[model samples]
Target: MIQRFIELGEGYGDIFEICELARTNADRLEQAFIMYANHNDKQVASLAISLKPVGDSKFMPIYLCREGIPYNAEKPSQRLAIFEEALAQLNVVPNRFEIKHSSIFSENNLYYQYLIGILRLNHYIPPMH
Candidate 1:
């Protein structure tokens, strides 16, 4: 199957959109994830929602708010809190992963490909058929 990341704007608003997408498509939702990475020595996260492939379509869409939130274990922010609350409503807790920051990639598409590889390796997304 083909998998791709669809990027949304960064912040709480985008997180809400991601959550809504998952909630609305819960039957087809494969996984909800928060990808964390260090950029410029600061922690940042991207919220992603993966959906199952449609009939005859190998492509799976992964919606994301790319590298926007500050990642802190001890400190929390309203943006992340909203995501957590939304996930609770959907009855699915997000799976977290530390990854290579997108900034390291020269192109945005490459960054997404890297993420897709990670997801496939983790079995979050299906492999090629």
Candidate 2:
């Protein structure tokens, strides 16, 4: 099976698109995620949704809004609120994970690969073939 992260840009206007993806593909929606990483000494989050492969297809798409939303336990984030609402509508709860920042890697793809490995080992996504 093939699994890939389909980035939608950092969570500015992309939050709505990510939510729409959940609503429209409700049947295939497998998981909702809030991945946290420290950037510029501030905590930021990446919102993502994992979907099952389409009928007979081997590709599973993980729609992601890369690290952008400011994250703070003391303060509520509007962007996170939007993601929560979408999750409520889909009856999906997000799995939160603290991770290494994307900047830690020389290439963006390597960052994604790191995330994929983490998810797989944690059983959040299927293991590689």
Candidate 3:
């Protein structure tokens, strides 16, 4: 199966969209995640929404808000808090993972591929079929 990341923006704004998607497609929602990374000594996070494949379409789209929010572990932010609250309302706890910054990759697509590998390895998403 093919899995891909669809980048939104960052933080609560992205979370809002994710929440809406989850609420609308509650049946197909598989997992919600927050990808964290350190970029030039700054902590940031990306929101993700994973959906199950439909019919013959083997692609699983993981919607994301590319690294933008300050890591809550280092500093508290209202944006992060709002995202957490939204997830709570959806009854979907986020699966967090620390990862390398996208800036390190030559292309954004490559960065997404790297995240897909990590997610598969961690069993957050299914392996290729």
Candidate 4:
């Protein structure tokens, strides 16, 4: 199985697009997760939704709003609240994890690759097959 992260810009208006993707593909929704990273000394988060493999290609698309929103557990941001509300409607409870910031990598793609590896290592996503 192949899993890839489809970045839909930072967590601005793009967050709505991620939520829409989950709502539209409700049946294919595999997992919802929040990835928190410390970037530039600021705690930020990325909201992601993993979808089931498409057709027979085994390409699992995990849509995300990359690290742009502030991470505050004590007082969640409105955007995070919106995402949570959307997930609630779908009966999905997002799994949260703190990870190395994307700045560690030279390119965004590399950052995503690193995240995929971490997810696989933790069994959050399936291993290559």
Clash number for model 4? 0
lDDT head-to-head 2 vs 3, winner: 2
Estimate, for each residue in 11-127, the C-alpha lDDT of model 1 and write its tens digit: 666877887898889888888898889988889888888899888888899898988899898987678788888888888878998999987899998988888888889988888
Instruction: Provide C-alpha RMSD values for all models, in order.
Output: 1.2, 0.9, 1.7, 1.2
lDDT (Cα, tens digit) per residue for candidate 2, span 31-103:
9999899988899999999999999998999999988889998895998899999899878989988999899
Supply the global lDDT for candidate 3: 0.83
Top model number, lDDT: 2
Q: Comparing 1 and 2 by lDDT, which wins?
A: 2
* Residue-by-residue lDDT tens digits, candidate 4, 1-129: 988888788655798999999999999999999989987778998899999986788899999888888988898988888899999999999999999988889998888889898889888889999
Model 3 residue 122 CA deviation (Å) reads 0.8
- The clash count of every prediction, one per candidate, is 2, 0, 1, 0
Order candidates by lDDT, high to low.
2, 4, 1, 3
Give TM per candidate.
Answer: 0.93, 0.96, 0.89, 0.93
What TM-score does candidate 3 get on C-alpha atoms? 0.89
Worst 10 residues of 4 by lDDT: 4-13
Q: Return the lDDT, model 4, position 92.
A: 95
Worst 10 residues of 3 by lDDT: 72-81
Model 3, residue 121: what's the lDDT?
95
lDDT of 3 by residue, 1-129 (tens): 889877787756576787788778777889888778998878888778899988889989988877787785856677777767777887889998789998899999889889989999999999998
Collision pairs in model 3: 1-129
Local distance difference test values of all predictions, in order = 0.85, 0.91, 0.83, 0.89
- Sort all candidates by TM-score, best to worst: 2, 1, 4, 3
Cα-lDDT of candidate 4: 0.89
State the TM-score for model 1: 0.93
